[model samples]
Target: MCSNYDSVTSPERLRIYFGVDAPAGSIKGEVWPLYQAPFIRRHPHADVGDDAVPPREAMAGLFGMLPHWAGEVAFGRRTYNARSETVAEKPSYRDAWRNGQHCVIPVEHIYEPDWRSGVAVPTRIQRKDGKPMGIAGLWASNRKATGEEVLSFTMLTINADDHGLFKNFHRPEDEKRMVVILRDDQYDEWLDAPADRSMAFMQQYPAQLLMATPEPQRGRRRTGASPTSK
Candidate 1:
């Protein structure tokens, strides 16, 4: 599962790659669960079968998904990633998957663990070409009692037990998996396709295009919050 990733691509970069309007806010660097990050999705009109308007745009959405029935954002902690094999059956993602709430999460790289040394060491994985990756994802929006709308999303992942690089990360006992990174040519079709056809875009990216290196975890920065508050 991809819980943490680098989202340092500037808004200008997104505009160029995705051919969509840039989000207003600055792009996040280290995007952790629950943090707001930019995601590319079909324009609202497209969802309603109106093709006269623009096709897609970029919006800031929370990293984790919040089912409409969920009372608070805390429920998102466990919904940050939805397994591709069962996303259509899982309560948290079934509706979105069926309703065609697909999105593309842009990231510079993703973090994983390397256990070859007998210990789990954090590793940074990115495309060998140094280009940003567009990970397939599902999104949902819920209105709060206070009349506020919350936009959230979850990255889709598939079993990577046979993947040359992905299978080396995480625990050996745990089912190996990796987020589905979409090819540049597949982005438009992925966002415009219907729910049933979305599954066809879940194939693993070629292992030859990826590279990984051990990266020591950085020290936590000090915050001004009091110890009691923390």
Candidate 2:
């Protein structure tokens, strides 16, 4: 599951890369669940209808799927990562998927686990060439009883048992999985294509273009706190 990731992409680069006209305020550093991060989606045209909308624009949304009928924001915690295989069938994701509520979550890097030492170790994964990656995602609009609309999203993941790089991560007993990263050529197609055809894009990213580095766990005290420090 892609629970955390680096979201330091500047607004200027987001405009240039996604070709979005809407201004994207800076969302620097790591983004965790419930944080408002930039996402690119084709907004619905208010004057016209669902079919008519301006080009895909950048917007900030919470990093979890809070369905409209949900009573509280806490539901998001479990809806942050939607499995691609059952996305269309799952209760929390089926509505968004069938409605073509697709989105691209641009990020600098993603964090996963490496369990080689019997304990899960955090590792940062990034493109070998150093370009930003557009991860496939699903977006939703939740209307609250208090007359508020909450925009949220969830990353789509797939089984990666055969993936060379991704398979090296996660627990030994757990099934390996990875988020679906879209290529430059496939971005527009993924956002515009119908549900049936869009399934073709749900594949693992090539491991050749990726790299990983084990990182010191965040919040770890470097000195004077832990018993091992002395």
Candidate 3:
């Protein structure tokens, strides 16, 4: 359900956190901060597995099915988040859930709306410690009979904590949910664990590390009921 996120951490910040040097040798913050819903980011080969083509490149086609895509012709309105609890049962996410289609959503923060008389009041969520959050994600590869590959991703959802709902920003009255957040120690398990074990790893995330607040959010709403947090 967590669709909005901030990936706009500066390259220098990433290098310091990672403690690794980049070849560019210089860095600065990106303009137009990385706030985005990130629906179907990078698109579909990412789910099935990578054998020949690079994984990131393999995912473009899958985004075609998402509602927010902005290609020459994009679906743009249908790109929605998937839920972690019931993903295995939904037709749109079943295959990825059962087949171990996993990924990581890296972000500096996420935006949620607090409903003030039906108006979505945007709020920002971030790691309690000021580090980046690595959110749980699902990926898939869409292949046709023609032998083309497409990759895509969707965030998983969970029930919202009291702080995550009423106290969180952009609180929509109709929805009470949030996304599954992974701990730094659980990143590898999330990305590489088998289907059953992966689910277990998901539960290990601590509640204390999760945090939220009111912050500016990006994206224009077209129409629909309040959406579940990714």
| Better by lDDT, candidate 3 or 2 | 2
Every candidate's lDDT: 0.82, 0.78, 0.50
Decoy 2 TM-score against native: 0.87
- Scored against the true structure, residue 30 in model 3 reaches a CA lDDT of 18
Question: How do the residues 1-230 of candidate 2 rate in per-residue lDDT, one tens digit apiece?
Answer: 87778874576767777766544554536777767888888666623655446567777778778877877876776787888888888888888888888899888889886899987788999999888899999898888723688788888898899999999887798888899999977887788777877689899999999999998564322331110100
In candidate 3, which residue ranges exceed 4 Å CA deviation? 8-79, 116-118, 143-148, 161-173, 204-211, 216-230
Error of 1 at 81 (Å): 0.6
Cα deviation at 86, candidate 1, in Å, is 0.7
Counted clashes in each candidate structure: 0, 0, 29
RMSD each, Å: 5.0, 6.5, 7.2
Question: TM-score of each candidate?
Answer: 0.89, 0.87, 0.63
Sort all candidates by TM-score, best to worst.
1, 2, 3
Measured by TM-score, the strongest candidate is: 1
Q: Give the number of the best model, judged by lDDT.
A: 1
Cα deviation of 182, candidate 1, in Å: 0.4
